[model samples]
Target: MSSTRLLVIQPSRTNPPAALAEWLRDAGAELDVVLASEQPLPASLDGYAGVVCLGGEMSALDDLRHPWLASVRKLLAEAVTRNVPTLAICLGAQLLAAATGGVVRPMEDGPEVGGRLVAKRDSVGTDPLFADLPWTPDVLQFHSDEISSLPAGAQLLASSPRCQNQAFLVGTCAYGVQFHIETTTETVLEWAAADPEAAERAPRGGFTRDGLDQLHEDLAETWKPFAQRFVRLAEEGPRPNGSLGRNLPLV
Candidate 1:
């Protein structure tokens, strides 16, 4: 059998797939990373078994500043329409929501930064990508925007106190998470250095070396298998009629 082919989209230079690329590769998927800021995005999802859109520093609505964002949103929409397994992270998740009839805006409470926990919703029990995750999974939160409302028919999977749309599933295969499961401690420190104000909003000791180290360890323990399961889902291809044989309620 051949390795699964996944398209990884990096919307900003500041944020790359980083550890998530390694995790996906370890799960037997071949990644084709597109730096959307520097490269042209594919016009279609053909030949790709899955899609992984990484985080970025830019706002999902900043098309004037970053024209390529429009293309990225189109690509995400196409991925969902075709039932291609997709995992959109952070800014990518915001773009996915915005492209799919959902709303994205500056977070009302403020930027949610630091290592945190998001409780899995009951619907996640039937989700292929999130079903096995612990009740509350550790994740890195570094975004200033939130998915205020999900796309119609989108299934809520996990949520945090500050942000309700922590994770969601669109259609049968597209998944989006508002947190970072792909960052290394170094990656987040770079984000912090660039945005001191947001960094300040993190919980006490959240960015300390000890704290971040433990957080990444916990993330690996919980999200690595989730990534692997995503690979398996991609390998299995879309299910019949795009249904998993369970009723996932819409939000």
Candidate 2:
């Protein structure tokens, strides 16, 4: 519990959100990060305290198009089997679902964008990875598809009104949050500027840089509590019976 090293799996060609490195430092994690463009898939998980999967443009369903996703799927499975605390963001969450006995698809619930409000699922009251502090919290978002279903035996934790499986617990006490609480204002701008129409067309408030900055300052206290709690879980390891079954396994 004292010396769990955190592994950052970044699938994006662009740099990871600034919040990631900052949060790792704040968590006192011995950090090691890798990008998809630089390294191949299924990198070693041994000695990694927890696995942090970051988002990217790739879809989790197209293993044939992006072979690296296949490797990530395998890696997530092994990490879960070993009871590692894995937090998958966006595409990573999709990968985690596809890795376990779940499906990843184009979301029918519609795209969730900007600073959206989310209620903590009943399961969040005493979650080991997420402690209670607020009835609802708003977070940044980016993604077209989401995990349509959870792995067998997983616990539902949090949900934005739009997405039912916004957060989940996959044995090992491992957790995944679909919304990007790890985003900063600058990162928000960087992502939003990618598409011109996104500034006002987003379903949620995450578009304007000014709006995001204000919210980031406001949410600092709220999200930090969850991030800190996540660090503890990463160090101490997930609760027993957190791994998925081999028979009811991810296809």
Candidate 3:
């Protein structure tokens, strides 16, 4: 529908879903951005056609410092329960995991930063968001915490050696990605500049701004279509009863 609208929850000032928003717009979905860092989330997922939660520097557990995160998590849980299409990235992924009875913790090996490849699992063949991806797709990793366990009934769609829960599907419409598909060279540079120590320890080897540019180009080749697919799913909207459908238990 030409009038379709999606809600984008930006949790951190530095970490916005830059390219993802662009791709969604190109796919014909209008966006209503909410800076959760500054404003309150609506009480429910009543109006939006879809929800997209972006990454941040904070741990998904740091609700004391960022009190709004709890509300965001509640909204995500609602999105899953209502069968609303959702895309959760990085910290957003961890939040989705935690909200849905999954486990999120600091990685034993520390952060996974910069460009890396995650292998697709066989289950991806049936996942609407991940079905057409390459066997190993390049993605940006910038978080220290990992999803050690998935929610019960969550379908694993992809993994990397360091992170078993790289990507997964919860219920029928909610998706979570441990790695980022929305980063740009400038975004990576800003993040790297903000945390030089982590930048030095990036697992894909320390990334240069130029290297990130190339990697982002590679990422765009694959993820743009994936984003468009998500938009198409949003266009489908919720069921006639305004429920996400009776697919799977969200939690």
Candidate 4:
């Protein structure tokens, strides 16, 4: 509603942040976590400064199995309409895409799992959250379905060779990322245990514990600052450069 608290929606158990929680707290933001897998969403986005939706095992379109997904999508749409700052990751991102007129289907080249690199687009240089990131930042890939297209007027932020729409900004403050920036080695193991079939389908260099740890080291160094900036955005309200604002309509 009218507080500095952020709504952290965990759609699944395995997607909790191993390091992101501390990072956000350190950046002067308080989080109100919602285990969406077990509970319904709030009646409105009125109490939170922002929303953060985590990844999950189910598809964005699988409302039949996880019926609450429909409510989650409606909340995400409400976030955009109200200009609430939002960060949707992996399955969350796919749901955001589908809610905003984008497409999400199985990747033609198979799942992009494990450590991977995504290059920042030219517009990222001026982007409030992604401006300071490296040209090609390391991120964990743990999804089979990819965002084939973006919502209307969505700004493309990062991309890899495998996935064309790796990260994007929809509306003013609602961001969706196809990659996992909030994972740890333990997180990966938990996800793997949940979906053992992904191990057989993983790319040659992926699925190793040691490799995953090494990749997490790199991701921590890079994405932690991004998370901090997001917290700052939530703390400071809208920016002058149009990175955030309730009045700024999506073009």
Candidate 5:
């Protein structure tokens, strides 16, 4: 049998898949990355085992400025409707929420930047992708806008004091996370330099080279296995009962 092929939609040049691409490939899935800013999104999800939409520098509502986002949103909606295993990160998460009737707006408290922890909700006890995560897993936050409300029928899976809609599940297999589990230190530093205001909002000492190195180390511990589990889910596909197969081992 061929390896599982996942469609990775990159909404921004700055926020490439980075470490997430390595994790997915390490988990044995073949990736086809579509830089949405430079190319068209696939009209259908056909022949793709899963979809992974990465974060972007733009707001989810910036369709006029970045028209390709409209196509990305459409594909995401179709992913949910078809029950394809999907993971949407950061701005991608906001887009997922917006595309599915949830609301997105500028965070009133200001941008959430740097490495932080988000507590897992009880609903994750049975979620195929989140059940195995640590109680309060380490994550990287660097977004100005927030998913103020989740899409109807979406299951809230994780949250933090700063952002309520940190992670959520749509339908059976679509997952959206408001944090960054995929950034390398270099990727974040570049972001910081480009958006100094947002970088300044980061918690004091959050952007040091040592700090970022340790942050990625912590992320690899928690999210690398999570990525593998996602690849397994993609490989297994949806079950006859219209569910993503088997809950992840909770231990």
Candidate 6:
């Protein structure tokens, strides 16, 4: 009777700093949310079919500033080792890369914001995630840093002008998107309100706080479908017997 449970390891308020909760609800997921900002990530990361690590201001490499970040990285590493599917966004993506020997670098050109088109690269035919979506998906973007390289044995899927390593397939099934496809306009305004720097650094012609909040209802409806697309990608992970679990309704 219940759907696949998603353990979201976010490093913000329980209500969340991202629209992750809203989008996951729309994806037909049963979210078992745990804010790493509130509690350290549980050591045992099993029991869930999927995991989602949401973005935050904290860098994955900065243990001195945020010790919980290091613990979360370990949790992510363990999750992948067990073949548990995951979707890592922004800092979470960087963490996935770093957990597998990749590096996160500050942008030479600075933060990328607003909506941008992501072109499907070599993964055009192979990757289940972007295979069905448009060849050039107009996805939301936000981030100052970028991943320089992928984790060992990863495949590049999609990219933008500002970030070359925009999306990647780690080993199999697990995917990471640098851009925030799940971000609703409410999340955008929340970030701008809480972090004044975000308002100033947003891409040219992007919205201010009031304008961002006003777009919440419209963006909320638009982002959910894209987030569900990601859910299907994760559900593609191989099972112990070489078969996947049943798909949940992503209506």
- When summed lDDT is taken over every stretch of 10 residues in candidate 6, the lowest stretch is 242-251
- Model 1: worst 10 consecutive residues (lDDT sum): 242-251
- For each candidate, the alpha-carbon lDDT, in order, equals 0.87, 0.73, 0.86, 0.82, 0.88, 0.69
Stretches off by above 4 angstroms in model 6 are 14-19, 194-198, 201-204, 208-223, 230-251
Measured against the true structure, the TM-scores of the candidates, in listed sequence, are 0.94, 0.89, 0.93, 0.90, 0.94, 0.82
Clashing pairs in 1: none
Task: Please provide, for model 2 over 1-251, each residue's C-alpha lDDT reduced to its tens digit, 9 standing for 90 to 100.
Answer: 35558878888765384676676668777767777656865456877778888888778867677767777777777677777788888888888887887777776755667777777777676666665757687776677787778888888877876778888888756677787777777776777777545445465533666677787875676777666776778777645755464443545
lDDT of 5 by residue, 145-193 (tens): 9999887778899999989999998778889999999999999999988
| Model 2 pairs whose backbones collide | 5-49, 100-250, 114-206, 115-206, 171-242, 172-242
N/CA/C clash count, model 6? 0
- What shift in Å separates residue 127 of candidate 4 from its native position after superposition? 0.7
Which is the winner by TM-score between candidate 3 and candidate 5?
5
How do the residues 1-251 of candidate 3 rate in per-residue lDDT, one tens digit apiece?
Answer: 36578999999988887899899999998998899989888888888999999999998979889888988888898888888899999999999989888899899987788788999999877666788889999998888899999988888899998889999887788899999999878888899888888887875558787788889899999999999999989889863322233443332
Sort every candidate by lDDT, greatest first.
5, 1, 3, 4, 2, 6
Off by over 4 Å in 5: 239-251
Instruction: Give the root-mean-square deviation of each candidate in angstroms.
Output: 3.5, 2.4, 2.7, 3.4, 5.1, 6.0
Candidate that scores best on lDDT: 5
Write one digit per residue (lDDT tens) for candidate 6, span 1-251: 45667888877651252576666666667888788877756777667778888787776677887877777777667666666777888888888888766778888887777666678886557555567666676666667889998876778888877789988866555568887755656677766666566556665655665655544544555456656865655555533421222221110
- Residue 63's lDDT within candidate 1 is 83
TM-score of 4: 0.90
Question: What residue runs in model 3 are displaced by over 4 Å at the alpha carbon?
Answer: 203-205, 239-251
> How many Å off is the CA of 216 in candidate 6?
6.5
| Model 1 Cα RMSD, 1 decimal | 3.5
